[model samples]
Target: MSGIEYHVSLVGNDSWEGTRSAPLRTISAAAEMALPGDVITVHEGTYRERINPPCGGESDDNRIVYQAAVGEKVEIKGSEIITNWEKVQGDVWKVILPNSFFKGFNPYANLIQGDWFTPKGRDHHTGAIYLNGNWLVEAAEFNDVIHHEGNTMLWFATVDEQNTMIWANFGNSNPNEELVEINVRQSVFYPKQSGINYITVRGFTMRHAATPWAPPTAEQVALIGTNWSKGWIIENNVISHSRCTGISLGKYGDEWDNAETTTEAYHRTIDRALGNGWNKEQIGHHIVRGNTISHCEMAGIAGSLGACFSVITENIIHDIHVQRSFTGEEMAAIKFHGAIDTLVSNNRIYRSVIGLWFDWMTQGTRVSRNLLYDNYTSDLFVEVNHGPFMVDHNLCLSTDSKDMLLNVSQGGAYVHNLFMGAVSILPDLGRSTPYLRAHSTEIAGHHTLECGDDRLYNNLVIAQKDQNGLSKYDSAAFPVFMDGNVFLNGAKPCIHETAPLEADWFDPSIKFVIEEDSVYLHLTCQMDWKNQKSRKLVTTELLDQTQISKLPYEDTDGKQFRLDTDYLGVARDESNPYPGPFEMIGEGRMVIKVWPHA
Candidate 1:
């Protein structure tokens, strides 16, 4: 098919030709008419409709592109502006909206309920109220909203079939004058069907989506979701204020998200997924990059299907999984399941429940060159994977001692990472987990339940005073290899022995000098005992030679990724590199890009 360009504007008519002079009114109209190799340039405006593309492009070279006009501000919202309001009581105002305004699916009537979703004993809606670009706190009941004076909380209820009543406290400001917007739609940009390939959405502000919890065993939804599609590029957008997830790259459930309540149910779901073409040719291979995703209740970017064989890079994801009354296993800034051959690098994740969580069948993945700090929970959590994965060149700085790393998997290699806190290893020794066949997406073998046989090489573990060091639950049958790692500030590097006991590798007489004004934590190693250097105490040999072959990191397209340099773009020595993420650049440390200024 021949390629064409379409245009959309706020003031244009829907029946007009989608040209630069006579643009379409709604993005939904443009989505219906866009074909392969077409470019739909939306002008500066606020559109309040979901753009569900009818179909995707045939190939990568002929993909459809939906982008904001160059240097223009385009906001596609899931909300509608409201102005009519009346004073109800002290610091409270009420507004009645017609039921016909919602069309068919009303988010105010939809309560947030799903598997692993906690409502804290009250019914919470996907509906939200925003006043002048700031979101108000959602109240459980109308009485709670009336009684609450601080934070400008709000409450809404569907009053019969004719109208919906909303009560909110504007905090001494007039509700009629302020810009009030209510969530009216479920998503801003999403395809209804699965396997929509080679679609690109860029440079738009998508907000106020009423999304649900995205579990791996169920159909996952988000503000912008791939919906079990392949070869999608969702980049350079500002996505925020989602009720559940911001960006979803997940699978569609077999039966309306009625899966994943139990282990047997999840296994059945996986079997159905395999039958429905869950391989490299059918699913995954998405690129989500350079996006600023924040203020989400569940996750910044989450997926069960879209995360596999994908690249998520250079994004700023923060303030996620915060202010939710519910708790679950799938809450993080960047959470993924079945992330085989994926790369998550050069991103800044902070102030969330967990920084980066890779759960269940995370084989052949790499987490490198990321700056993770100020997280409420741990920086990295690797759960339930007998990995052939690598985690290297990351600056994991946590304020609490127990918030650095949590490892529940075996066969992972931690190399050249700066661990500024403690580490916890909790392995389940009851049941074995499934592993896929080598170089294929089929389940083949099962690794025995153990957390040992892991490797930690050339890492700098800086533990402060009165902080806990590396600890494990119990000793495993296999040993955890530790080599060329530096322990500073009286930190003890402990490992499990076969006798169900802990063994410390460092001596008590080691001293460390802390530099206060340094950006990087500077520590000078000092040993009080004679002829006992810090490197002499730890063995530099490999505990298991077979595990070394698993360290070849590959990207989503099956290309090998080279780690020849450190985090600061410094070259490493061929024989012996430095301990931490930075290879010693003269005297001071080589500084990498920590925060994105663009």
Candidate 2:
């Protein structure tokens, strides 16, 4: 049976019965009135309040769906406008507020501290100041705010026992005249309790949250998060301007939050989690799709062990950790720890620190059809994983990426991808990371990393002049499988390839540019390498079994996988396909739109 419908509008009262004509004033009130199978529709205009759903839906079929009304622009934010500012110095302004004004949790009083977070020789706060939707960089101290640099918008805050004081360099603008705001709340739409399941949040423009540093061992809450829940769908939203992570599908709160700093301590975290419902039925399985998440200080999406058996697809995530105000270990567009059987596909990630980071226990995970470009760091990073993982049909065209594929792990299959960057292979004999069983979260075994058993097949590499490619893997600890690969533009091949095709004399002129929400590739390429060396269609039999896990390259259900499809889902030739991500294309002076195709 269909459940009740609750309406929320800005001009409604909390005492009124929630109907279309008599809507409620707050979404939280509507959430309180809602139950399983209930639908809460928020009307247009901004709502400066937090939405904490007390309970959740029972199942996917009967979910508590909270959606913004169609054709109406709804904005949910965690900041408050402040017009009461006094001019302190030239281009600098100050605001003083009572300690009681923060409602018991003052962001100015809280430091941005957690395990693995680097403050860069100074302390930083969780609070932020914004002038007309743009954020100001937090200063390291009061002296930094006093001696403002040219054109740098900076803010500094100090909290005493009774009051909190803030100073900001407005950069030639009047803070009282303009729309200036400050961070007040920690998060916008986050459930306070763990194990909240089957909730759907969609179509709202959420912004300006004071989220903290989200470590793997902590109760990683963010601007929007599942909080160790299951089967949550966060879709079709514009989430931005977070002090840290934007969306967190991560671990729950316990005594171990920020307490487990070392690797051995983290293994104990995993062991305790395994005993307390860290399985397929209880955790992970969250779907974050079709959202534009940007301007977060930390990751766009972060998960420790709560992102398993999930699908992250069709999202546009960028500008994550781009400001570089500080340093940290966990900074990426999408960062996860144990991404077992997770499918990360069709996502566009760029302009971030790192694109995709599968940290540990990345077994049976599939990374396909993603467009990663112009990242500050590498496009992909796999650390300490004993994987049977697959990364295929991706456009990792980042000439600025020092190492496009930083595979510090082993047993990975890279197929049909176009790379415009270098590769790095490094062994990890320090930390013994775990690898899970096929399609399950149960820990099968653990070992230190071996930088070998990698398969680079049917791929194209166009590196910069004098840039290194797969030659770095020549001294790997174990043997690797390298075949059917073409290197161009001074790119080097591994010594292991029996018959490598190197075309340093020919310039492919590979470059991709964005125009009108489409990525266009411009190149002058050739197909002469096909006759020089035979290319085989990469399949499960060719990938075979990983050395450590002893599992074949297969789908999540243990079915044999096929590499018979290109990045655009075009059919690949079974006998002999072209060496790149494209099977069929023009040869000379080719300019084609290669992304966002139907």
Per-candidate Cα lDDT values, in order, are 0.75, 0.89
**Candidate 1 C-alpha error for residue 187, in Å:** 0.5
| lDDT per residue as tens, model 2, 395-510 | 89878877898989998999988888888889989988887778888988888986898889978887775788789989999889989889888789999998888987677877
TM-scores for candidates 1 onward, in order = 0.89, 0.98
Error of 1 at 207 (Å): 0.8
Specify the highest-lDDT model's number: 2
**Per-residue CA lDDT of candidate 1, range 1-598, in tens?**
4588999999888899999999999988998998889989999988888888887888878899999999999999999888989999888899888888888877888877766666778777888888887777777777877888566566656556788888888887887998988888898888888888889999999998888777878888899998888888988999999988999999885674753466556666667788888897878888899898998888999987467888899888988877766677788999998888888998888788899999877877889888888788899999878776778889888656265888888777787787777687776765566677544568866655467667676676766554555545236445676656666655566553222111234322222222441133333332221111222111223323324234333433445544568786778754556666766634322233345422
Question: What is the alpha-carbon RMSD of candidate 1 to the true structure?
Answer: 4.9
List, in order, the clash count of every candidate structure.
0, 0
